[model samples]
Target: MPAESAPVGRRERNKQQKLERIVTAAAELFSERGVDEVTTQQIADAADIGTGTLFLYAKTKGELLLLVQNSHYADALERGRAASADARTPLDGVMALATPIIECNRVQVENGRTYLREMVFGDPTEPHHAAALAIVGETEQALAETLSRLASIPAAEASALARVVSSIMFLTMASSDAEVDIAQIVEGVRTQVSAILPR
Candidate 1:
């Protein structure tokens, strides 16, 4: 409870408050209107801040998207990691790896699908790419480690397997919806992994 510490605490609190407002505004507006239609001005207005304030918080709309995506993605991945801590088999580990990510996407499927389509196919300069890499890079290493353990493979092989695993993951979960049946997709991958592997 030192006087000097009070200022630092206040600064942190204020920064968090501003970020919360910005994120809340962005989430609602983006979900309701879609990413293409929502503007920075609208987010700022919704947050009760100046457009200049929003810019101060984020360099571009892409950066804000990245910031928001990072928030939710990291949470989901953290959940995944915790879930995987007990898994022992390769397929069980793969399930550990895939299920939480897809579970995460399940919550934000629509906007997520829009954001992902834009990321892979639309622009070269999306903000989420770097952030996504950093986020996935963390999980990627864990996934690579687990795959290496389960398959008795070398690091390079494990890395390649992780990429293929992630690719299948992205494809399946990117299509996740409130109503789409994904069990078959999961089953198909389970059936095909051995077929795809060298004897």
Candidate 2:
């Protein structure tokens, strides 16, 4: 059969629809009441699925946060990458690449801080932690690519710089008492980028 005419199996479609419902419900609740206040049973009720089904999707509330935020983080990375294309300097490029993430995190700043903390110490074997790692790796790579082009540096060097920048950015935001200041982050990134790039 032609690729365009290929039919999706019923079970697969059902699984995907169920997963979408879970994410949608979780996102809504988590946004309205904070992750710490929400429960699996409540999420299941919102999703119109059984509590057991909800557990199958996310074993814990933390995992549910991961499931809901993964795509948002991915989209932020993409926007950051696109924004970097218009940068006039290496520092500008770096800041452009980081701005979207700062803005995205601001939407749920408290939960964003908690998610960062969890990723630092969470079980590596868990699916949610793995998904967080994948997103982090992609963000680093995008930063590295932008830095490499803007700084005219080797990819390896740019990658190293990107890692440091990513660490500093995360730590800075995570250390904040409440919402992160994107402008502060941009200024800090400018200093770091200037220090690393050739005079």
Indicate which candidate wins on lDDT: 2
lDDT of 2: 0.83
Model 1, span 71-148: residue lDDT tens: 777887877777777787777776776566665555555667765554456444545566676666776777788777
Residue range with the least summed lDDT across 10 consecutive positions in model 1:
190-199
Candidate 1 positional error at 28, Å:
3.3
Clashes of each: 0, 0
lDDT of candidate 2 over 102-161, digit per residue (tens): 777767777787778777777778898899889899989988888788788799998998
TM-score of each candidate structure, all chains considered together: 0.75, 0.90
Q: What is the lDDT of residue 128 in candidate 2?
A: 82
Q: How good is model 2 by TM-score? A: 0.90
- Predicted structure 1, TM vs. truth: 0.75
- For model 1, the stretches where C-alpha displacement exceeds 4 angstroms are 1-15, 31-37, 118-129, 175-179, 182-185, 188-199
